[model samples]
Target: MRRATTGLDLALAGLMTVAACAEVVISGGGGTALGFGVAATLLIAFRRRIPLVTACGVTVCLIAESVFVEPPDRAVPMFVLILASFSVAAHANRRDAAFGLSFLSLAMITTGALDAGDDVASLLPGWALFVGIPGGVGVAFRKRTGDVAVMEARAAAAEVAALEAVEAERRRLARELHDVVSHAVTLISVQAEAGQAVIDSDVEGARRALAAIGAASQDAVAELHAMLALLHEPSDESTGSTSTGLADLPSLVAGVRAAGLRVELVTRGVSALPPAADHCAFRVVQEGLTNALRHERNAQVRLVIDHADADSAIRVESRGTRHQSSYGGSGRGIAGLRERVAAVGGSLEVLDHDGTYCLQAVLPR
Candidate 1:
């Protein structure tokens, strides 16, 4: 882009130099006038790079032509001065542009006074018409270009922010769906297996397992619908609702019990927590119970929700004599839980010792 601009500048300088020389010859001006015209016109090539210097050089040439040669026609010199004033105003900073404009206008006024023997007061308005108008137009053009550039930069930043927000929403939705579906599906699978095993021997046990499966499936569908509704109209409070949180622990515990895992839930000062921390606590417990059910169905799980300290803590410990390999899950659930906890400015830890597994999370308010 810069190279193209330079090429255009050089081309414009060459053309203007030819025009100035032609004008001087047609006006029957001498070689001195022709020389001054070409020099003033050629200085325009450096206007964008060193606008103040170019304007000063052009002003000197114009004044010298009026003083020394006193050309029959001063049209070419006046045109070159106008072009220099505009370039200086457009390309230079405010202070330098102001100085250049004042200097060029004063030089033109002095030249007019010297040529016509007119009063400096009478020449002021004419010089201003030649220099001031072009400078003002150039300043307006510069301001407009700067405003457009600022708006474009802001629009680009907004687009990037919007994209980042969308990606974050996608990640959040994936985590929520994974937790809801994984927990419910695992329950349904276990209940289905239990029902199949006892279908011939115990009719009542089989019936209960089938009932649990139906309940788990229904809950899963309701949660999915809620998430979908959020997608349709996120700003509509009636449609957008959250998934399970700490307050729903009773139902969660009951569901796990129905799935054949023994869960003992203890609460201490968990009356009020921020929504993020509350939801994170629920996911920790849910993932922990789901892991216990999948690996050690008969294990006794002790779940604790404590918010007595400055920070909230959740702990789920499963007591059983299962092999370490049994608890080695695909790691998705734990990773999701960790991400959830971390997002809420919290930490998650999982421990396995002596055939026992523990999931612990600490969240800030």
Candidate 2:
């Protein structure tokens, strides 16, 4: 569009320059009028690049043509005046635009007054209208162009930010899935190995192991469903069904216990929290216990939530195991928990004192 407009400008300036040359040749003017006409025409080529300078140059030409040209009845070089005035408003800054318009309008009025053999009032209005209309139109075009450019820039910026936010959320969900699925699969793998090892010799032990595998599989599926439900637009039924919170911790503990780990849950002065806080608290406990399951076999784990303290806090501690397990992890569990807690305006702390590993989260009410 801009290139097309520039092409149009060049065409207009060329046509106007030819008209200016015709004015000079037809009038059979002296060198002064011809020189002024030529100079004004040449200056139009630079109007887009240096509009103020070109407008001023054309205004000076108009004045010179008025003073020096003979057969003053001919309104010569008026096209250049109008074009320069329009260019000034379209391209120049406020002060330059104002000054250019004023100078060109006054020059037109002055030339009209000097050339008139009749009432100056009749001619003044027509010339003023001629000068003012182009200037006004140019100013309006400039303002509209600027406003549109601003809106477009803001829209582009908003789109980029939205894309960046979606990317960040995908990364967050990836971390979450890694932690949840990894924990469940680890327990299932352990149970499967045990069940296979004692399949014939110990039938009851094999039965219990199979049950644990089933339970782990169910837990993994439930968690995955909850996450998937969260990803879509929530309907009333789905919203109520898949949400997990502090109330679900008992079942979580029961599942962990069934997998042959001892977990103690203790709470004091901890009333029901908001869903986000409750969910974060649940995750902290879940991740802590998962870590214990992987690294500290037969370790005693204590999960504590205390709201009576100045800062409402949940703590998960595991006394180091006498025998470490072969199971390992990518170590994203604690980091994911920390990010989750931080998202809800909470803080997480992990402490290793002597042989005990403690993970604590303090959340604002």
Candidate 3:
């Protein structure tokens, strides 16, 4: 049950009991006491669905009034019924309270006219005011309250969902920045250390290594600038026409081979590659090869791009010796790749079997 509804019912029960008891004591408290007490008990016990029960209680009140002597207080029980109708209408909802009220109004009007004793027409206006107006208004207020509750709940849910989305994106950005910055810094540090260690014994080698360090640092700066621009100002002007794709795969393979490993690049799908598809595909292959080099160095690598069917899908696969312990990943790379693919209605898989780690992707057009 809604909290508002429960609170309303409890409050009505308390108020009715106290008011009914006070009136009973004031009005001699003699005849039809049992009927009034019973009606009060029923209304309090069934406070939420009061009008339905009160319809029956009010009918009994009219009957008890005819059969008994002292009319201790007819007004008190009628007032309690009025209060109960309003309480139910305000808390529960309009549709239910409307139905409850219809019956209560009919019972009240019929009872009033019946007790008129040949002046039934004069009693009509009083019946309408006492029963018709309050019940109708009670139902309207209940419906308005229900609509307000629904709107509040939707607003709360939307806010929660939005916050969760922002948090997830922040975590993704943190991971991306950490991986790129750390790997570049590590390479620069390793090269500087090698140059320092060899400066005295091998002057020529130290100078050559320092030159390589300079090149790596420049490459790092360029990459940092590219990524930062993509993040901070991702407009058409700032990004330019530069892209990493299958068109650039040969150069990428050559770069990895130069880094001291044999890399085989094979392609079967050149004519069917969309630029966006190719770009996303290129990142997957680049990240895969980089992971293999950094974690499983000294292992042979095979890179293959197959444009299977040339229309429905494209697949890229890279394999190398498996790494049990990689410095950068905690197994979230493949999951992130899968999430990216799923965004574009694609699929990704990474399997380490028979001493080889194979990364595969299938992207749709």
Candidate 4:
């Protein structure tokens, strides 16, 4: 693109040179006209790169023509002065523009005064109109161009920021979906396994296991529907909150226990928590239970939660499993829980003691 623009500039310079020479040839200009025309045209090539210098060169040529070339032809060739003034105003900085305008004005005034004889006062208006108009128009164009450039830059920045925000939201939603689906699926898999084993041996135990499976499946389907509906119109109030919190832990434990994992819930200093903190706590518990059910079947699980004014916390620990379950995971549960902890301004600590796994999370009230 830059090469194409440079080529066009060079072509314009060549055309200007050709036009200057042609003017001299067709209008019978002798040595002085030919020299000034060729010099001004050649200098015009650098107008964009060194606008003030090109403007000064063109002004010098125009003044020299007025002094030396008799019976001057103010034709297309002389328009090089206007073009130089426009370039200087449009491309050069304020200091260079001021200097170029000052120099051009002084030169034109002096030349017109010298040629006007006693009618010098009459030449001022014509000189001002010719010299000021092009410069003013160029300055206006430069301002508009600068404003447009600034607006374009701001628009580009806003677009990038918006895209980044959307990506962050998608990641959050992905983490949420993982937590929901993993917990429910893990519970269902564990219960179904238990139901299969007990169906042949104990009919009552098998019935309870199947019931837990149905409940887990219903919860999974409901949560999925809510999640999908929220995705469609995100602002829908009914689908926003799950209304699941610390109070739901008993049922959660019961569901997991039906899967054949011995579980206990111990709470200390229970108090009301903010919705965000409450939700984070619930997810932490859910993810921990899901992990235990998958990797540590037939092992004892303990959930300890402390809800207070200053420091609220939840801890889950699972002893090594005696029996391995059929269901497993890719291990994104803990990482997703970590993101949840961070969102609620909390800290997470994991403990590895021999084969046992313990997860502890502390959140601000």
Candidate 5:
């Protein structure tokens, strides 16, 4: 693009030089006028780079031509001056452009006074037509171009922000799906194995296990449908049936108990929190219980939720022998939980000592 622009500028300079030289010769202005015209036209090449200097140089050449040659026709020189004036206003800053215009106007008035003597008043229309109009047009063009550049820059920034927002939302959905599927699958697997082990001797026990599996499957399907609804239509409303909070701890604990893990729940203070923090706290407890179920056999788990003046705390502790046939994990559940807690300005910690494992999180209100 730079090469193309440079080529066009050189082409314009060459064409103007030829036309101005021809005009000088036709008017019989002699060698002096031809030299001045060529010099003025050559300065057009550098107008974009040093517009004020180019304008000043062209103005000097025009004045010199009027004084030395006094050409019969001033058409070419006036046209070159108009082009120079436009370039000055278009490329130069306001102070420099204003100075260039004033200098060119003063030079034109002086040149007209020298040629017409006392009849300088009659040259006002020519001065305005050749210099004033072009300078004003150039200023307007510069302002318009600046406005367009600003709008383009703002549009580019907005596009980048939107892309970032989309990527963040995708990560959030992946995390939610992972938590939901992992917890339900873990419960169903444990219940199915228990039901299979007891099917020969204890029909009632097997039937209860099957019922738990059915319940877990139904819950998972409902949660999945709720998540899918968000993809179809975004909303500011809470996730309705799928949105879990402190009040749902009893049901969560009951489900984990039905899956064969022993959980004792304890609570303190009033459970009041912002939606984001409340949701994060629920995930913390859910992830902690899920990890305990996957890794421990006959584990006694204690879940504690404490709401205080400044923050909310959740702690899950499990004590049991490690399961010989424990389920494998991809290690994303705890990491996702950490991200969720951190997103709401919270901190999570996990500890293991001997046969005991503890998960703790603290969230600001």
Candidate 6:
């Protein structure tokens, strides 16, 4: 701020001296003192925002030039004052700067018209073009500044969108990991228990149980590795190795149905599920079914899978009226579904308002 004030003051003083040289007598010392003093005082008063003060100060100096200084003929001095004031305003806001530029440009044209002293029409157009061209360019710069601001806003939004997309992908991977890891761990536990239950009574059955446990553990490790791979580098989105899709829905339902869920699935929109959409859709249904079976045993479940050329949808509602216990688990399943679908540019909503638990999901293609 101090530097700016000093620079403006020095510049103003120098311009005043130049205007002094434009005179023959150098005898308007009193007028010079009044005019320069008024502008300098205004400068000091508003030095923090010199552009604002300089605008009015330039007009005051012009008036002082015509009346008190040089006796009505200080064209060069007036023009210099105008230019300096406009230049100061140029660094502020573009709109105000344009106003200042116009003021200076008009002053120049008006001065030129006066110097002609005859055929005002001929002199006016030439003067306007000569002065207005610079003003017009200044106006263009103002517009360019506005354009830059608009582009900056769009860039900011794009950055936000990209960040949101990444977060969504991570959330989706989390849901998939939960399903794969949870199911595999359950199988491993069941197999381990079976092996213990029949350690000696049926050696062959026990061996099969052990083998199943090993396979389940390997599957768990592989699933974990896949999840870690995705988490390590999100950009590695090669889904050629995708194992879970809407095609896996039947087995998922059958798993829960075996646990006495009475799970029934009705699928729609079967023709157009992209790999990403299909995977997310399957996750949503699987989580919903798992939740239903875990909490609401013997509950009749109606699973509706809808897909179309543009969208994939899943809705799982359980009629656990006798139990009222289907949605009693951690409730992370629905929340996880919401995050996963939203990540893939879809939506998930669960509404259990009328003695039934209803889960709806949409994953757009």
Q: What is candidate 5's lDDT per residue for 83-192, written digit by digit as tens?
A: 88898899889999998888788667767777854475657886787679989998998898899999999999999999987887777887888888989988998999
Residue-wise lDDT of candidate 6 within 130-188, one digit each (tens)? 44454455456556777999999999999999998788666666666667765655555
What TM-score, to 2 decimals, does candidate 2 have?
0.82
Instruction: Show where candidate 2 strays beyond 4 Å.
Output: 1-19, 68-76, 117-119, 197-201, 231-242, 308-311, 321-327
lDDT for model 6 comes to: 0.60
Say which candidate scores most in TM-score: 5
Shift of residue 203 alpha carbon in model 3, Å: 7.2
Please report how far candidate 5 places residue 347 from its true position, in Å: 3.1
Question: Each model's C-alpha lDDT?
Answer: 0.82, 0.77, 0.59, 0.77, 0.83, 0.60
Model 1 lDDT, residue 320, Cα: 68
TM-score for each of the candidates: 0.87, 0.82, 0.74, 0.83, 0.88, 0.62
Comparing 2 with 5 on lDDT, the higher-scoring candidate is: 5
- Number of the top candidate by lDDT? 5
Candidates in order: C-alpha RMSD to true structure: 3.2, 4.1, 4.9, 3.5, 3.0, 6.6
Give the range where candidate 5 is weakest over 10 consecutive residues by summed lDDT: 234-243
| TM match of model 3 to true structure | 0.74
Cα lDDT of model 4 overall? Answer: 0.77
Collision count of model 6? 4
Instruction: Please identify model 3 stretches exceeding 4 Å from their true place.
Output: 1-15, 49-51, 54-74, 88-98, 122-124, 182-216, 223-251, 271-279, 309-331
The sequence of per-residue lDDT tens digits that candidate 1 reaches over residues 1-365 is 36323777778888999988888788787888888889888888888888898889988887787788772246666777888889889988999999899889877776877766566576767777779889998899789889999999999999999998888677778888888988888888888888999999999999999999999999899989988878877542112434567888888899989988988888888456677677778888989998888877478999988887588889999986564433245558888788788877899999998878999999887
Cα miss at 322, model 2 (Å)? 9.5
Q: Over 4 Å off in model 4, which ranges? A: 1-5, 63-73, 117-119, 122-124, 236-243, 268-274, 307-311, 322-325, 344-347
Better of 5 and 6 by TM-score: 5
Q: Clashes in each model (backbone N, CA, C under 3 Å)?
A: 0, 0, 0, 0, 0, 4
- Which residue pairs in candidate 4 collide? none
Q: Output the TM-score of candidate 5.
A: 0.88
Please give the lDDT score for candidate 3: 0.59
